[model samples]
Target: MKMLKMLSVVFLSAMIFTACNDDNTTNGKGKASIYITDAPIDDDNVAAVIISVNSVEANGPEGWETIDEFEEPVDIDLLSYQNGEAFLLTENEMDAGTYSEVRLILNIQEKVNDQIQNEGSYIEYLDGSKEPLFVPSGGQSGYKAKGEFTIPVGGVVGVTLDFDVRKAVVKAGNSGNFILKPTIRLIANQDAAMINGHFEPDNLDSAGYNKVVAFAYENDTFTESETNEPAEGEIRFPNAVTSSVIIGGDFTLAFMKSGTYDLYFASYDENGGYVELIGSYQDVTLEAGTKLELDLELNLLN
Candidate 1:
């Protein structure tokens, strides 16, 4: 059902956009750009999700005018960019106005008799195995994230697309084929916020944590027992808006809108299984363009 709903959103704006010749056209225009980021997937075995992007476009006077064009499709490792980190997809000038949506033209592959075509998009595993990350009927068109951003006269505006890989990558029922449903959002860079913090490393005296995942749930809505697994395609923290993987005692929950949230920390086993809820804090509010910091003490697990 989730995959169906996601595909429905994709089909609504899956039109194709052609390449545009660059005239170096920038005079009395506003600078508009797009960035790409991701949320951590809850699978420990997977090393990366690679996607090839040809160009990025915005909805404007010419239907889909290419703002930034690449000579060759760039392969991006989505996992390498997360936790407030983003890759600049494009940066160019446009006439000052409101744009409806951003389209990322992915160079996808065609499947022939259950075999994938040349390297379109695929997943890399820790043990050196790769499999096609299929996007249904996505090769012939574009995928989009809908949002509104206005460019001021002679001003610059940046929008970041947050790709939630946890919800976007799903396996076919008993088939082992992974599909990408493209759950994404566009946030103006000036209006984005984040919660970042450092964890005091505590070697649990021979029972140390293997992995930790941080979640920013709706304010006052997180529960200790939400860590229990639900259905197959869903995770425990249903109300979580964003998540981050704690790396080297640092974690950042990025691309969040200004709102109150409850931050929760939990430990995961090597296989990404929920081990236990480490701790949580309530009523943490964020304002636009601010990075709130919280220093987690080591005694939270006691």
Candidate 2:
């Protein structure tokens, strides 16, 4: 049997800009730009995951302000922006202040020939299966994320929103349908860090796999038993600082915060059907703006 290789890599780009006016006034306006990226999910059965974004908005003490709007909705294939790549969404000028919320409007429905059609969003599977994926309350109300951030005068701030596809895409029980719940985080570009390395398997060709899965746990006491499934408060699978997929023995988990974490790696078959626990390291400390490198060997038991 010829097995297909599935590798997972995801990224999100949310650039926040705050510029100083000519007079450097306290309440002056600045330029705010928005971008979109993806954290890819590796599944042999899934061929494509597409989403259409229409507009972006931000809220502050004054009121809700429009950052960027698209006359035609932008269709994005989440899997394509892998390995730390990103694309621009939109840009606009806004007053300098602390924005408390951000909103993303998606194209879930459209009016065609004087009739409301279901021309919103969909996903394609490897088995030639296609289905519509719905976003609850995302069309009319838009998806809103709340956080407090300040744009200082004479400074440019870049923020990144990491969208995790593994946790956001849900499969209905035996129904073969998928739902997009959207798991995202807003992080300051300056405070971000990365952890990357290479893994060498004993037998590369016959290993039956093409990628290795890496996970980071905040708790130092996390063990192998907890990795079999997602354990609330213990194992952070989808939102786990950065659950990276190492391709061709190389991997990089970026945008991590400064702290101590437990790192674990496992090998999976090309079709993503089989998995084996290689090993793990505990108390790995990550500093801000620093790239920490660590290498390992996958020792499979006979």
- Top-TM-score structure, candidate number: 1
| TM-score on alpha carbons, each prediction | 0.81, 0.77
* lDDT by residue for model 2 (127-233), tens: 87777776666676676665566655555555555556666667655555466675765555556566766666554446666667777778565654654664432
Q: Pick the candidate with the highest lDDT.
A: 1
Residue 82 shift from truth in candidate 1, angstroms? 1.9
Against the true structure, candidate 1 reaches a TM-score of 0.81
Off by over 4 Å in 1: 1-28, 60-63, 111-118, 203-207, 221-226, 298-302
RMSD for all candidates, in order, please. Answer: 8.9, 7.0
Residue pairs with backbone overlap in model 1? none
lDDT of each: 0.73, 0.62
Error of 1 at 73 (Å): 1.0
In the range 12-53, model 1's lDDT, one tens digit per residue, is 111111222333234446778678889999888999999888
Clashes of each: 0, 5
